[model samples]
Target: MSAQAHPPVVLYDTTLRDGSQSEDVLFSAEDKLRIAKRLDALGLDYIEGGWPGANPKDDDFFRQAKQLKLQKSRITAFGSTRRAGSKVEEDQVIKGLLGSGAQVITVFGKSWDLHVSRALGIPLAQNLELIFDTIRYLKRHVDEVFYDAEHFFDGYRRNPEYARQTLQAAYEGGADALVLCDTNGGTMVEDLRRMIGEVTDLGAPLGIHCHNDCELAVANSLAAVEAGVTHIQGTINGIGERCGNANLISIIPNLKFKMQRSLTLDDEDLTQLTAVSRFVNEMANRPTQKNQPYVGVSAFAHKGGIHVSAVLKDASTYEHISPDLVGNQQRVLVSEQAGRSNLIYKLEELGIEGVDAKDPRLTELLLDVKELEHQGYQFDGADASFQLRVWKALGELPNYFELLGFRVIDERRVRKDGQHPMGAEATVKMRVAGESVHLVAEGAGPVDALHKALSKALRRDYPMVTELKLEDFKVRILGNRKGTEATVRVLIEWYDGRCRWGTVGVSDHIIAASYDAMVEAVKYKLFKDKVKPV
Candidate 1:
């Protein structure tokens, strides 16, 4: 069916509810408000804020969300259907949903025959009654009531009649929509298509809520859409319980561009896709996947010599879709595997000209860098710092600072109690902007002392240094057999309030490697500030 013939597909976002189940994820009430507003702005039909009565954090969210008026999306309060024996008005969960002040309410009801008899300790008939009464009662308070038929796919296969009966109960009780959930996330596409077709034949407005355990959540959701389901429930980045929920990131593009469906939000401005994806990852404090479909850092990156050469001729030769189509720019990765074409691309991006791709000296330099990488220097992950280092090595960089000779000393004294080492001291000397500075600082470690000294020196020129803090520091040994003789690689991540960047350093000495990375981190901040001006 054509998109114009059908109603606009409703988007139910569960980032606030199910997304919190991702491992090590905890969002403060303030963060939830921020994400909720963004989702609302994106034109989602429903925002599942969480189970307010179950936790203080969700309760706070409902209370706080009441003060703000979201123009597009209806905030939804999610909970399970009332218990078999309890009245909907008497159940704490139903009471919480009523008090949440959400325009819509979603309640999950048992659909699998095994769950009804074994999990809830109720007969098939009582389970159906619970589903009916819960929806009937909720319809009284909320304008829109959605029933989540949990494990509907598995339950339908096990006992098709009982699953249909459960849905029948919700339909008879005045539910606005029935969401068929792939709770186990193990259903196949063909089966989901057939099952959704069966459910849609029941004559209620149907929605698909899928999880990614079998890695077919997106496919199954699409299948349901083809089978005439109008609503898609998912989370950004597919973050949720177990594997994750279906990813709206992947689904949104597919529906809008490929399937020719009309999205509730604008699809013409595709550039916002990457920005929105990155913004969500940053707010969640989760690292963006480097190879994640359209928005990943490496999604459009060309590294192979053959691929780069072909792309230089026609981007469509290697790219399935234009990078600009998704608001992402093409990146040519530099490595030992990269060719002269890749080098030229990198240089052009750096705004450096007059260097021929076939220059003998440039070719020799490229070979040397590749040899270094073959020995364990990774440039891709540290492009910003690597670019600066390359510019300095080529004598093309502007001279901003210099480092003077320095010494680190540690003294230990024997005590009557048989103590061996007492403490250590670190001293640093550096010349920046042609001015010499010397400072002594004590730290738990030599690397910490070096960071403190560098910060002290750069404080005068860059007042933004205070906002820059190291988010991560890692050291990896390049050679395993040499033990103490092995070279160490250090990576440091720095962040201001608005943005974050990473840099790397390598040396035989651990302290020296850390110092190198720290210097690059500072320089990167300064360079970006001067160029970008936030």
Candidate 2:
């Protein structure tokens, strides 16, 4: 087929609707509004807000969506087909969907005969009426109506004749598009592609909605598009029930750059793919997966000497595509795996002078980094500590401050709110500017109390430390050691007004690991200021 053979594929983002089905994913009204704006900015064709009348939160989202003016993407309200044996006019769910201020309405119906008989407990004929009347009635009220044929691939496999009839009913009812849903999400890519090829002439524009149970959601979605499906439904970062739905972050770039097909997002919008992925992950408060396919932190990070050397020569050697094309940058990671050339490359990137490319000292530096990593000190996620290591390697690290001693007291007590909260108090003493400063503070946890006490002691001397706020704190257990005996690796992310950096520490005690990382964070801030004298 030629490039001009098919129209542009419409990207339908269900981050609010199906994405909420993901465990631990809860979006407030403000979060939904923010994500909707981001989808609009990404130039997605459709943004499916949560189903109306499902809950008060979804109701609030639709009410709030009315105030926001999206420039490009249209807001779509989702619902199911009219209830079994109920009038489309009297169906409260259908009415709720039309009352929703969205320009488009999507109603899912039973495509599989087993679902019609077992799930709905209704005959196949009545289910067909439900699909037709629901789409037909809503089409009059909404500008566009999409019918999601739930369990389409499985249904087609079981009873192809019955599945075609259901789709034909939707087509006759005037649905603008028919989205084939892999609700159970277990269909193979080849099976789904063959099924879609047979169903393309059902008298409506075709679409694909997939789940990642088999880890083939993206592949299956592309197969459908190749078979002339025009609409693709997915969630950002593939957040959904069970495994996940298709990940738009992967599909968008694949369609535009790899498949060389037309999509709603242009080249510039495509570059923001990583930023959008991180933005959504941040809003959900989920840790960004470093090893994810396209937009992950480690997607473009090169650690081995062979890979880094070749990448420096020509990035296309090991990389499939330019990382910057998807808003990610190449990283040269340092470890025992790195060669002398890698160390030289890193020294040049860091702008550190006097380090010869062939310096024998680099071998010791490399060994130290590898040993630290072996002890659960992860330098890849900790830029601040890594900088400290580089300075120590050159024997030029400054003595920022002298820690005298620190103590922490944690107690469990019932508060006035009738809640037994952990009461934590910490004392920190440090010598700064030739003066001994002692401070005490209390917090909800040992780490918080320690940070507060340390900040209080250094407030007058290092006023910039107050601007450094811990953004995220994570602890990973190392090796087979279990429970309290386990060695812990603590990674702390800190952000000043302009810049963000990570620090890491490792120890058998969690609190000790946290304190070590926190100290690195403070020292790095002070070091940057002394270098620039700002």
Candidate 3:
């Protein structure tokens, strides 16, 4: 069939209502308001705040949102249709919608015959009546009313005529829009397309809501769009019950840039999509998905030799879209799998360039680093300090400071015959700037002794060291088949109040690796301070 001549697509974000159902996601009423304001800034067409009658927090959210002057998006209150055998005028849920002060009201009614008979314990006829009466009542109260036919796709597959009748009920009841929901998240893409076509043939403004049980939520939403649906409903990060609702984070750009659909925002604002996606993830206290379609951190990162080389020639060779188009910067990851091009790219990012494409030494160094990385050293995540070490090893780095010598001593005594126990003591000495600094301290362990001694020695020359501390320390055994003879790799993450950096060290002895990582951490902090004037 020829594509229907539909108006520009509208994005209805359910991040607050549906997204909160995500496992481990529970946003307070205040957080909901904060996210609502941010969603408004991102130019969402509609925001489904929450089910106001379902909980006290949602009620408070509606009350709070009424005070804000959101210019672009309308606040939508979500709820279920009137209960079976209840008049719309008497249903408490319908009354709550009337008092919510939302211009748009979204209510879900059962479309699946199974849900009608089993879940709601009502006859199919009463289910259709419930949908009709609820929509008609909400239409009288609000200018815009959307009827979410929950399980519309599954219902269509099971009882196509009954599902169509439910849609007919909402259409006849004056629903401004009808959203077909894949409530179980089990519908296939081809079925979704055909079903959406069937509904569009019924002559109502169509919308699509899908969950990610089969990991096809984004594809299903897009398929519906391809089938003449005008409204797309989903959460930001595919966050919802079970798997999640369709991720608008993946959908918006696909629609705007790929399908050539308009999103009611200008191109300039569209560039902020990636940033907005990250901002929402941050507010939700969840790590953004690394491989998320349009805006993930690794979406545009290249590591393989062939992929990086091709991407350098033309990003379209490997990337679906330019990173800059979505306000995301491209990255080259360095690991055992990386090639010379990846190293060169990383070195250039660090403002160092001496190796050439055909340099024999470049290949030798790459192979050596890769061999080392295969043993658990990740230089990609620690590129700053890794590059510094590479330059130092190549005799290209200027020596700003050199470690003359260092030592640590610990003494402990135990009481005997009721005598008091003598305290333990540790001492460390290091020479810097032609001056020798020595400090004696007590610690419960060798690692603590080393940390205290080093900090004491460096405090005079680097006062900022006081602000730095180890955030995380992880030790992994490399070549475990070698047993106790295996090498250990240590990763230390340091936070210096403003920013964080990671450093790595590998050695047969764990203490040695720890000390090496410690030295790199201090040097990295100093280097950053010298270069950035912080």
Superposition TM-score, candidate 1 onto the true structure = 0.87
| Clash totals, every prediction | 0, 0, 0
- Model 3 CA lDDT for position 340: 76
lDDT of 1 by residue, 467-490 (tens): 777788878899775889999888
Residues 1-534, candidate 2, lDDT per residue (tens digit)? Answer: 444565888999999999989997888889999999999998999999989998999999999999888999999999999897679999999889988888799999999999899999998999999998888898888799999999999999999999999999999999999999999999998899999999887657999999999999999999999887999999999999999999999999998878888876888898899999999999888989999878999998888998888988899998999988899988888766777667777787788866886666777788888888878787788878988888877877777678998899999998798989788999988888778888899988999999998888887767888888989999899979788899999999999887899999899988889988988998898887774222
Question: Which residue pairs collide in model 2, if any?
Answer: none
Alpha-carbon deviation at 272 in model 3, angstroms:
1.9
TM-score of 2: 0.92
Our tally of clashes for model 2 stands at 0
Q: Against the true structure, whose TM-score is highest? A: 2
Q: Each candidate's root-mean-square deviation in Å?
A: 4.2, 2.7, 4.6
**Model 1 lowest lDDT segment of ten:** 525-534
How much is the lDDT of residue 369 in candidate 3? 79
lDDT of each: 0.83, 0.89, 0.83
For model 1, how big is the CA root-mean-square deviation? 4.2
Candidate 3 weakest ten by summed lDDT: 419-428
